[model samples]
Target chain A: MAFFILVIAALLVSVFFNSLGAVSLYRFPDVYTRLHGATKCTTFGTIFIAVAVVLYAVGRLLESGENRFWVLIIHTLVAMMVLLVTNATGAHAIARASHRSGLAPAKAVVDRLEESCSRGGASQ
Target chain B: MFIFFASFLMYLLLVWSGSGIPMIEVVIGLLMATVVTFAYKTWHPEKRLSKRGLDPRRWFGFVAYLFGPFALGLAKANIDVAKRVITGKIRPGIVKVTPALKSDVARTLLADSITLTPGTLTVDIDDAGAFYIHWLYVEDENPSEEQLYGNFAHWARRLAE
Candidate 1:
């Protein structure tokens, strides 16, 4: 009963955050802020989903004493790690490319990147 | 050496069944690990992964950070972003943070950590170690490492440096 409750709660959290991620794309002003919303929220949401799946796998492993469920847990973890790394790196790439192509943030109070670009760009 | 052993162990662990493992699987695992190690070395010739990560203490620290501060910050970030998404109150801007990290591994770790947690998206890292971040709520033009990413800089230094 407790295991099912935990799994349900995890799924609920995952759905809420994922829906928020979709909403954020329309809510934010520019690509950067939109990236902030879409990337972080989805990444976090997927993490919860992975957790729930892992929990399910664990329960199966314990109930049946199956070695296959162990593999299921491992595969889930590997998928989660790949998603986490790729999500963050992809966000960075999009943000950098947008900034490089002269797409500035909207309604900004400060842009040190633009400031640095104006001042002959920052060098090592 | 580190890559080879780590990959070998991982491959064996995945291939392991409840019964005794077969010799063929062990041979295949060795071959795969060797190929991966050589490919990694050729791709990043300049980066000789330091022995620092090999220290067991660092691994323990990293695991603790993952479940402790990293997890907490991720929760906070999602809640904060969710609230802002609903209310439509965002003070967005690109600001700079200079975290004086020496190694590339540490810098990348910090950048990824910053991006995943909080209202910060790592836009770019300059030729120097300064990070240009798109903050949802820009409170400071010149924010410190703590302001931008809490103890992530310290954790990066501990785990990767």
Candidate 2:
């Protein structure tokens, strides 16, 4: 009963964060802010979902003592790790590319990147 | 070589059945690992493979860092973003920081860590090894490495460099 409750709670958190990611897309004024919201929220939301899956797999393993449950648990862990790495890296690439393509962050307070770019030839 | 043993072990780990693994499966895993290592060596030729990752100390440090500071930062980051999402108050900007990270691996690890840490996102890493980060709330125009990324710089240097 406790395990079920924990799984449901994890799923609920996942759903909440995922919806926030979607809402931020429409709410944010610029690409960088939108990327921040979408990338971090979705990655965190997916982590909770993965946690719920791992918990379910663990419950099955303890109840049935089956070998396949071990595989499920391990694979879910591996998948979560892959998602974490890929999502962060992808966000970095997008930020770098957009900046290089001359997309300054909208409504930014201070733009040090612009200052550095204009100071001297900091080109590659 | 380190790659051979690592791949072989990984293959066995994936195929583990809790029940004792059969000898033929182990044999096949070895054969697959050999083919992979052969292909890898054939392409690289110069055996300049760094064996730093083979160290058990580094692996333990990395695991501890993952579950310790990194996990805490991840939770804090999500909550912070959530608060901003609800309130819609932000002071975003791209600020620069120059950490004395000599190795490419350390730079990469730091950039990725900063991205997932808090209100900071790594936008560009210049050829001169300085990082331009997109901070949701830029506290200072010229921020220190610690201010931008906390102790992640130390962890990155220790773990990767």
Q: All models, DockQ values?
A: 0.74, 0.68
Candidate 1: regions farther than 4 A off? B17-20
TM-score of every candidate relative to the true structure:
0.94, 0.91
TM-score for predicted model 1 compared with the true structure: 0.94
User: lDDT per residue, candidate 2, B46-158, as tens digits?
Assistant: 96767787788998999999899998998899999999999999999998898989888889888888888788899988788888899999889889887877899899889
lDDT of 1 by residue, B1-161 (tens): 88999999989877876566899999999999999999999998888777767888988988898899988998999999999999999999989888889888899888888998889999888877888889999888888877888878888987887
Superposed on the true chain A, the predicted chain A of model 1 yields a TM-score of 0.96
Residue pairs in collision within model 2: none
lDDT of each: 0.89, 0.89
Q: Listing candidates in order, what is each one's chain A TM-score? A: 0.96, 0.96
Q: What TM-score would you give candidate 2 relative to the actual structure?
A: 0.91
- Give me the runs in candidate 2 sitting further than 4 Å from their true place: B17-47
